[model samples]
Target: MALLAAFVGTPVAAAADDPDLTSFYQQKLSWERCGQDLQSGARSDGAGQPPGFRKRLECARLEVPRDYGNPGRSTMQVQLIRLKATGPGKRLGSLVLNPGGPGASGVNYLIDSGNSFANLGRRYDIVSFDPRGTGHTEPVSCGSKLAPPPGSGADDSLAAKEKRINEACGRYSGGLLRWVGTQDVARDMDVLRAAVRDDKLNYLGFSYGTKLGAVYAHEFPRKVGRMVLDSVEDPTKNAWQTALSQVRGFQRALDDFAADCTRQADCPLGTDEGKAQDQLRHWYQQLSEQPMKVKGETVDETSYVYALREALYSRSDWPALRQALEQLRHGDGAGILRLSDAGGGSAAHSDSVPARRIGQDELPPQDQLALRAISCRDTSERYGADDYPRAERELTKASPLFGPDIAPTLLDCYNWPAAGDDASRDVAAPDAPPLLLVATTNDPATPYQGAFNMARELRNSSIVLTYRGEGHAAYTTGDPCVQRHVDDFLLSGTLPKSHTSCS
Candidate 1:
């Protein structure tokens, strides 16, 4: 998810002797058309304002302080986009959006899927922005040389890669690395709320965006307007806890996909779910020992494992997964490579064959580095190399397929140089108006339990809107019930009674 700020007509005046951010708060924004020929990579200019771009989207840049504490010294430009309300009715204020990825560009997300919010946009301006260390927002880069090449998943190798990544980030990220945490982003949101002239924040955040929204509500409860947190992230979870939960969640999602696949006539893993899971595990083990060559490209254990996890994110991708597994069973790595590509595996390692174009929702190298930097800085958890053995055993016991892979990821934060001041705090927004929490029961990314936990944390001020389906999030997945509730809340501040289920 993302946060944005802009200075309209008059600059927002700063406090008399406080943080001296008045100049930044008062800077004006200029918008220009954008998103013409987006498929071919055409974009706006340096100011992020496209000249004569034929899209309704208008792009601009918001200059926020690199460090709010030192507002005048240096600044980072945040990319912003706006889709004005196409209304026949009374217009509400801006409804800002964040599409999860601590790395995802909210500006691009709104450009691609603005119509999804048409119902709400008719009543409110739809606004989005690329948060710090993300697209066009003074992005953080840790040199691709430090990035682990695709299929390189050995424990020792991963540890070495993590070390290199840490060193590289420290070298290249400037001092902005420590300030990119969600807390900092939330502070940016407050400045944005004021600049946009919204009395209160009206926001819709998905996946990681939920965490951002919750932080915002906690930090500025009174400034929160109608908010929807889809696929909620548990604010109470430390990094290790969050990783473990995700391991188990992905395992459950894989099991569900495997079970459903067995019912299909072309199911490659056969009719027995247990045997199929074992087959997959065996495949991973074998690939680890001897990488397979398919379509003139190598398919290693790490790639296959990541592909499986990716396919499990949504049931709609199950068909492709099944085909990939079938091809794997037949000694053809082509399908596996294709699935890996879909899962954000590096294209450099992929074969030159013309594969179907998967949506480029995958984070760029800089964005991925930023994701790690922000995540490491935001949480207090520090996992050392020695902590892996016990964690591996426990995680594997809980989730045999995904545990091993997920456990090593914790090591990335080992010996992280930057430290964040905002420890995990109680997210109870007692003073905030009603908030809506949306949870997909079988969500693979943000597990359903996190939503329940967030609802409880927020106490009576929040309502949990349950989508009894399988996916990462609820809204825009063709669930009219979910959309209706979100629209109602955003349009009229209607909060469903606690624990309302929309199957």
Candidate 2:
């Protein structure tokens, strides 16, 4: 509350006056040849790629407030990429995108999947930025290895580990920890909208990005143009509720996987649902007693659960998950370890893979730490170790396979340095134009209910496109039907009928 009080008393103009951000909003970017060190996806349109499109990507940096309230205190640069529209169609200004991950890098996303934006790219300049505390935009750093060695932390209490992380972030992170919340990022988005010269914000945000997009709508409702939120998160849910939702979501995906697995003759989980669940639970017990090693890294019960949770985000990974589980019975830990190290190496974002880096492996340590920094700062929930046991029992009962893995997330904000504000979660954009929300029924990261919840909060101004499918996102799944609706909306501002469902 003190944090909020300090910012609220800033007169808001103190920032613009102190830092004189009018200069920032008026400054123009100097584009240059992008470096391979930065680019993630293939550089150009591949064979059979989208037509009328070629990658003319360029990179630049935009200056923003390190502390938005007291902008004169400091400044930080936001890394951004632009995929100029290639089509002969009349330009529709700049179309900005955020690929969820409150911690995900939009710069990498645009460069990696430039071709995916061919349709919109031809009509609008597709732009993305690495939000603060992520990518090259002054990312959060924990100074040391985030987790204590596999078995070493076992002796420490849960709160001790939490304190260790809090101390490390407080020590490092370049003094940017307190300012990386979604509200700050949304403020950055407005500056981004201005820097790009877009009269209004046209955006595509997925997962946590949806939270970002919705907050932007609330903050700058009149400035919103066409917006699409996929794999949505219910901003109203605090950190603990969000964690609980993910637990249930992962468990639901597991049941879905189990049901799908039994139909296969070579199913490792067996034919009966009951037996399949029992088998999985039994493997958890087995892995707990005898951890596996792969490529010089330890794979304990915690890693095993994470690997499974990672696979549940997309059905495409289910085959790998099955293979991993099968190979586990045969004592090979390589497959599951790969999945564990997958998902952009971040902890929570259910994003399958970046646009350009197919079969990419090894998520950066910073991404994992950034997730904690941004999520903790936005979430006001300050769960203590005393609260862990009850949440654990409840989550475990909800999902014996995934609950333990998620229980620890509830405590992420315990000793966080910055105080979280309600503005990040309040998405009451009553005056904003209608927005499109694409949600998948079986999404494990941002459950479908979150999308529906978002629509409700938007005051019935959002159209919900339900894809009764699996995966964390809908449009990226290559479902022509889903893509058509999204393309039509982004390209021509068409909205599917309300309560529309696509299989």
Candidate 3:
């Protein structure tokens, strides 16, 4: 299939008449302190309010072409949040970061994770952005998330719901729906790199951000400098294979969590392995029949499953998953709801309603919608009603626990109104400098094996940094060993020894 979807490359006029992109690349951003503009407040443990903005964080908006192929046609506002380097040492220019949501808000990530990179921040300004179709960057939404209207037929088949979602997305996403793919975002990053006055792009990305970074390296090989891709995603896998791989990883983590849960006296899942499995399945059935209320939101099987799946991303989240399950048993679902509201980066799901603007507290969250849209746009594969059953069957066989919940997601691009491209399906950046890819041996979201594949595909332009631990990404796990290796690379371009593994 021609990778560029129907919406791509069709000249607004002709290729020869392309508008000058010099202006877009040369524009300067107006930086200001982040406060109410981003609903700044210290992020509490819960998801009730937006996270607190750091006192010294600077925020700005960047303008790039909505469609780079036709820069003169329209433009998009990319939201940027930065924490300047605290310079006791020499400045290392700007180290841009992407918090791995093909749909999540890097702007929010900058606020939440800015301090994690304080070590790097001493010499490099930590910058992050909300890419198109995510967060505050003209997010693609499926209208307002309204419950199905009364008499809205009971055909809740995945095909039926996906059809509505595709319709709603096409209805609301406008011209950018098909353009939010990683290929486009990489171009935007290049513009960002130029706008920041940096000759090369120094980047840190997690999960999907790794894919984005790899795409960037492929596009602008010589422009890459000191890049880190944590929780590397396999570029070889199609959307279906990626889903199956991730499900297996999560199921393994779930099993491990269950084993540990039974050892605890207060484990909600109880001590018997068989009983624990049965009990959790029972919750799925129970929630499906009678959705519980928490914070005025319904906690159905979909939300419950997302909550469970997200908590599996890191070992640190296991305790919260336990609490959410415990609360579920007690008919108090705030814990589960919190996880649902906070889930994204790799995979997350939600419902839809009438149209709604991208703003604070929008249901389904911009991240999930962006994930669905961008995932479709990045691939040329389009499933019909027929493909759903086969995909679901294979997915279920892969992991009985999460397979069913994740199966419906196979059709995320079903009859997508806009055509998609396969530009990201394959990446070849032979000219790019060696990239440091951090992979956890037992990561639930982006499995470890994929890291090897990604490195091989980068045509050996990557060295794997293995973290023999549990988590979604290593840098945020407070592992001094991992941090030491990463800092060493970014600080002085020192590569860790071959076969380096940190506990």
Best by TM-score: 2
Candidates 1 and 2 compared by TM-score, better number: 2
Instruction: Assess every candidate by TM-score.
Output: 0.86, 0.88, 0.86
**Deviation in angstroms for 159 in model 1?**
2.2
Specify the poorest-scoring 10-residue window by lDDT in model 2: 352-361
Per-candidate Cα lDDT values, in order, are 0.72, 0.77, 0.77
In candidate 1, stretches whose alpha carbon ends up further than 4 angstroms from where it belongs are: 1-17, 35-54, 147-157, 343-364, 422-425
Of 1 and 3, the candidate ranking higher by lDDT: 3
List, residue by residue over 446-469, the lDDT tens digit for candidate 2. Answer: 888888889989884789999999
Q: Write the per-residue lDDT of candidate 1 for residues 1-503, one digit (tens) a residue.
A: 01334323212344676677656555567777764433222222323333322267887777787777778778877888888888979988899898776766676666556666778878898998888887777788765454444454644444555655676778777477887888778877776776666768899998888888888888777788889998888877776777778878888888888889889999999999999888888999998899988777778877787788767666677889998899888888888887776632110111001112112122235556667777777767677767878888988898776777777667767767787554534677777786899998998778888887887787645888999987676786768999888888889888877778998
The 10-residue segment of model 1 with minimum total lDDT is 345-354
| Candidate 3, lDDT over the whole model | 0.77
Local lDDT at 95 for model 2: 89
- In angstroms, give how far residue 128 of model 2 lies from its true place: 0.9
The numbered model that scores best in lDDT is: 3
